[model samples]
Target: MSTPLLSLRGLLKRFGETVALDRLDLDVPSGEFLALLGGSGSGKSTLLRMVAGFEAPDAGQVLFDGRDLAGVPPHARPLNMMFQSYALFPHLTVSGNVAYGLRREGVPRAERDRRVAGALAMVGLEGFDRRLPHRLSGGQRQRVALARALVKRPRLLLLDEPLGALDAGLRERTGFELRALQRETGAAFIMVTHDQGEALALADRVAVLEQGRLVQLGPPRAVYERPATRFVASFLGGANVLEGQPDGAGGLDCPTLGGTLRPAGPLPPATTACALRPERIALRPGASGTNTAAGIIEEVAFRGDDSLLLVRMPGGAVLRVGHAEEDGAPPPRGSTVQLAWEAAAVVPLLG
Candidate 1:
């Protein structure tokens, strides 16, 4: 394999008693769209800033294109960052903002104009380059910020919650546009986001970070289907975590449910968590199903296309279920209901 486009070696940072990054290491292949995924305060943003030269690492070395980043200023590095808050200049027009970086670099007028036009076009804002920041919509302003970053043609693009400000409908549209734009440019994009769905949809690989470390890194499907840790499983998507013991039968012995459930993964005797995705648990009770629990309906929220039912299982386990074919079948609050899940649907977490 060739050398990675960017590499971090023993990256360490600190603030008072807090260790922002603890001997962290990461590598980004050329043209790879990798997402640094985690909840708030997971240190993903700190690592990204260190790579962008905004924060100095206390111990580790940062390398871009095999060159050491020691003493290389942010302006000198082949990198650009787009913050969650577009940070557009209210006084500058779209074209003026996009041309700011090129102007500082002393690029000739003709070349700057050509690059600016191309960048704006790439982000679908070609004809609107003359609009002020206030005149443009939330999505358009974000595109302008992206155009400004692309005008410099940096090798690495660091996006921190790039679509955070947009509404839900606009966010979905921008996600597709951004993915296509990245593919067209082939820039190694490393996005730091708390939205697990965004990362799964956009990134070729996702690094799930915890307190201050990478808990798991893999393809979206792999990470979702087989999370290395219990935290990863529950964080990426909602899961019903059941505390149970392994029975001699290839299933879990749930004393609360008084039944055995299909094993999600090979579980140890000391396993404390059983991860079963909401979708995997069926609403219609199965006769031969290995696991079944009696619960009372606690809450029923009817979303547009589906219904979200919160069932309070025996022993106080609140299991969330999504039903697709509910025709106003309201299980009255406190009414008893049977919850059944396939024996093979449960994955055990023993760590």
Candidate 2:
């Protein structure tokens, strides 16, 4: 295989009592869009900061094109990091702001103008060059920030919560625009985000973090559809964990779980606990099966397209099920209901 454009080898970082990153290793392919996804304390932002040179790793190496980036200052690296705050100059006009980096780099004024204008056009803010940061809408200001970052034409772009400040609608739109821009420029873009939906929508692959460690890394669909462990399933949501007896072949035989559930992934031999996501579970409702469980509806939450049903099983485990139909209106809350699913849908997890 060709060498990754960027690689992190055994990278480690710590901030006083907290271990921000723990021997993290990752490789970014050329022109790929990667999302560093995690909760508030998961260390996604910290990792991004380190990658951007704002913070240095305590150990390990950061590689660009197989060359070490050790000791290189932020500006010397072939990268640009767009801060979460945009960090736009309040006093500079849109064009002036976008041209800031170019001017600093000592590019000729005409060439700087051309590159800045091109970058602005790419972000759909070509005509807003005369407007100051205060005069621009939130989205427009963000586009200008993007233009400034892009004008430099770095081989790699790091985004720390790029859409965190925008409104919901604008955030959605900007996600698409960013993806399109990545493809057009063929630059490797790594984004840090706490929003699962944003990661799902934009990333070619996602790296989910926990306490500074990468729990899983894969395409968005693979990470969501086939998580690596109990931690990943639970973090990504929709998983209904069940304690079971391993049946040797990635299958779990649980008396109350009502089926012979096979591991959708490689289940370690000692695993006694398993999880089946709500969406993967196909109910054989009211049908008799080994995988069928007797449950009482505890709560039913109505979402427009799907409903969340909490079912208390005979074994005392509460199973969260998601479905478009409420299973006969969620069995009238507290009524006994039968829940069944396929063996393949069971995603086995650690004990």
Candidate 3:
């Protein structure tokens, strides 16, 4: 196989007593959209900064297209980083802002003009060259920042919470726009975000970090459907983690639910817990099938397309369930309902 466009080998960073990155390893192929996802102090931003040359690791290597990045400054590196704030200069026009990097590099006037124009057009800002940053909307400002970064034609692009500044509706629309822009440019896009929805929607693959360690990395659906650990299962959302011991009868001896549950497939010998997504559960009037349980609805929340229900299991465990509203309304709070799920929907998780 060909070498990855970018590679991180045993990367480590520390700040006195705190470890920012703990020997993390990653690779990015050409034109791939990868998101670094984690909560605060999980090293997502730190890792991105190290790659962009804003920070250096104490150990290991950062390789860009098979070349070492040590001793390279941010401007000298073959990449551009767009900050969370969009980092646009209020005094500069859109064209001027896009051309700033080129001017710093001493590019000739005519060549800079051509590249700036092309970059603006690429980001759907063709006719807004003369507009200043203050005059542009949030989305427009984001586009200007992107155009500025892309005008240099970098081999890699780094985005730090690119859509965090936009409202919900605009963020959703811009997420697709950013994905499309990355595809069009064919540059490997590495983005750092704390928003789970943004990572799931925008990234081709997601790297989930936790407390300075790499927790899980895979395709969005794979990571969500088959979480590697309890942290991942809970952190990525929509999962009901149940702690139990093997019943030695092709199922789990879950004390919390006061029963046994057979997982979809054979589990690892050491497996002690499992995750079941709320949407995978089917609610009905009676519990007569395998993996069935009786629970009282503790809370009901309507979420437009679905209703999120918190159910109190017979053994006192609160299991969250997301039931689709297409068929009918969810049972009212305090109603006893039977929850059933297929074994296949259960994912065995590590401690």
Candidate 4:
């Protein structure tokens, strides 16, 4: 691959007695949209701030274009950050706010005006240049902030919960817009978001963090479909993790699910858990496979496109299942059904 436009090597950060980050390393290729995904206090914001020069790592290096960024002031970095607040100047009009960065950089007046206009146009805010931040809608304000950040033509753009301020509908809509804008501009973007759907939908690659440590990093599909650990599978949603130990006959003896799960391939002797996505499981009328178990639908939640089923297995384990709406009305609550999944769908996870 081409040289990474940005690299964080062995990065470490701490606050008092808490370790905010622990020897984390990541590489961002040019124009790749990477999302740092984690729950609150997972060091995602700390990592983003470190890259933006707002915070310093206790150890290791933050490199951009192969140059160390140690001691680089926030304003001196060749990157721009858009915060959750949008941070557009309420006193300045859209164009003025966008032009502020260029003016700070001491660009010529004509160049600043041209770039401001182009940036506003890029974000679909061409006609709102004279509107103040308070006069614009939340989405518009967000666009203005984006315009300001892009106006400087930064090599890397950092977004911290960029869509967090918008309503659910708008947040989902803008997520696609942001992804499109990133692709159109070809500027590498590193977004920090707690929303799993946002990260999975917007990012080309996702870095999953847990307790200040890098837990998993990969393409969205890979990370979601083949999570490396129980935390990842649970955090990303729709995973039923069961305590299991290798049965020695190429199957995992899962007492909770009351079955022996035979994954597609051989598992390590130490493997003690198996994770299966809810959507990967199918509810059938009768048991037919080694990976099948009988369960009663204890609860059902209709989620528009799909219905979520809480299946209580005979062993008293509640396994969440995502049954497609098209499969007909979900089995009524209290109805006993067979839950089956292919052996290949079972992912053996090590503790």
Candidate 5:
């Protein structure tokens, strides 16, 4: 296989006694979109800063292509970073902001202008060249930041919470646009985001970090569907984690559900827990079958596109079941219903 476009090997960072990154290692292939996902203090931003040459590691290496970036300055590196704040100069016009980097690098006026125009057009900002940052919408400012980063034509781009500043509606729209832009530019992107939905929606692969350690790394679907650990299953999509004892016959005796669940797939050795997604469950009026449990509806939450039903089982465990609005009105609260699911829907957790 060809070498990865970027590689972090045994990276370690610390501030005072708190460890920021604990010998974490990762790789980003050429033109791949990778998201670094974690909550606050997960070392995601620190890792990004290390790659951009803004921070030095106490141990290990940050390799771009194949060369180490130990002593290189941020601007001297061949990659650019788009900050979460957009960080456009309030005084500079859109074109001016995009051309600042080129001017600093001493590119000729004619070449700089051509590159600036191309970058602007690439981000769909053709006629807004003269508009100041204050005059543009939040999304427009984000595009200007992206264009500025792209103007240099770097092989890799680092995005630090690229959509954190946008409203919910705008963030969703811009995410797709950003993905399309990444494809068009064919540049490897490593984005640091705390938003799980954004990571799953935008990244080709996700690296989940916890307390400065790399917890799990995989494609979004694989990570969401078959999480490697209990933390990953609970963190990514908030899967219902049921703790139980292994029955030795490829089944689990779960006290929470008051039953034994037999998964279609073979269980990992010493498995003590399993994850079931809320959407994987079906609620029936009256049902009695395998992999089924009766519960009373504790609450019904009406989301815009769908509803979430909280069911209290006989064993006192509350399970969330996602119900689509298109299926007509959901059953009222206080009603006893049977929650059924296929054996294949249960995913065994490592811890």
Candidate 6:
């Protein structure tokens, strides 16, 4: 395989008694969009800072195209970062802000102007150059920040919560624009975000971190459907993890469901648990078959596009089931219902 565009090997960082990053390693191929996903204090931001040359790693290496960046300063590194705040100069116009980096590097006036215009056009901010930061909408400011980063033409771009400042509606729209821009540029991107939907939708591969450890790294579907650990399953998709023991007859003796469930796929050795996504479950009033269970509807939550039904099984374990709005109104609360799913929907998970 060709060498990756960026690599982090045995990277470690600490803040007094707290371990910010614990010997984490990752790689990003050329032109690939990788999302560093985790909650606060999961070391995602610290890792991004390390790559940007703001925070030096306590141990290991940050390699870019086979070059070690140990002593490189942030500006000297062959990369640019877009901050969550957009960080545009309030006093400067959009054109000025986008050209700031090029001017600092002493690029010729003509070349800088051409590059700035091209970058702005790439981000769909063609005629907004003279507008100051405060005059533009939130999304426009985000694009201006992106234009500034792209103007540098860095081999790798680091985005620190690029859409965090936008409202939910604007965030969704800007997310689509961000993905399109990345594809058009073909530049490697490493984005730090805690939003699971954003990570799954935008990233080619997601690197999940927990308490400074790299827990999972793979394509979004792989990580969501075949999570390597219970934490990953719960974190990525909020899957219902059911603890069980293997029955002698190729089935899982799950106490949570009050029965044995035979998985369509062979269980890995020592597998003692499984994950089932709420959306994979089919709920009805009188469904009965293999992998079927009777339950009482404890609650129903309508979420516009879909509804969530909480069902209490015979064993008193409440399982969430997703009901699409197109399926018509869901059974009312306190109604007796049946929850059924395919054997293949039961994903074996490791603890």
> In model 1, what lDDT does residue 146 have?
97
Candidate 4, which ten residues in sequence have the lowest lDDT sum? 283-292
Q: Which residue runs does candidate 5 get wrong by more than 4 Å?
A: none
lDDT of 1 at 104: 96
The TM-score of candidate 2 is 0.93
lDDT of 2 by residue, 280-344 (tens): 55445568744566777898798877778888876667889876674445446877777767666
What CA RMSD would candidate 1 show? 2.1
User: Could you tell me which residue pairs clash in candidate 3?
Assistant: 264-343
The digit string of per-residue lDDT tens for model 6 on 1-351 reads 888899899999999999999999898999999999887899999999999999999999999988999999999998899998989999999999999999999999999999999999898899999999999998899999999999999889999999998999988888988899889889999999978999999999999999899999999999988888888888887888888899876778888787667789787778898888999998755777678899889999999999999988887678889999989999999998878899988988876
- For residues 60-123, write the lDDT of model 5, one tens digit per residue: 9999888899999998999999998999999999999999999999999999999999999998
CA deviation > 4 Å runs, candidate 4? none
Full-model lDDT for every candidate: 0.83, 0.84, 0.91, 0.90, 0.91, 0.90
Location of the lowest summed lDDT over 10 successive residues in candidate 6:
283-292
TM-score of every candidate relative to the true structure? 0.93, 0.93, 0.98, 0.97, 0.97, 0.96
lDDT of 4: 0.90
Clashing pairs in 6: none
Model 1: how far is 87 from its true place, Å? 2.0
Better of 1 and 4 by lDDT: 4
Worst 10 residues of 2 by lDDT: 323-332
What is the lDDT, from 0 to 100, of the residue 288 in candidate 4?
85
List candidate 2 segments past 4 Å from native. 247-250, 253-268, 325-330
Better of 1 and 5 by lDDT: 5
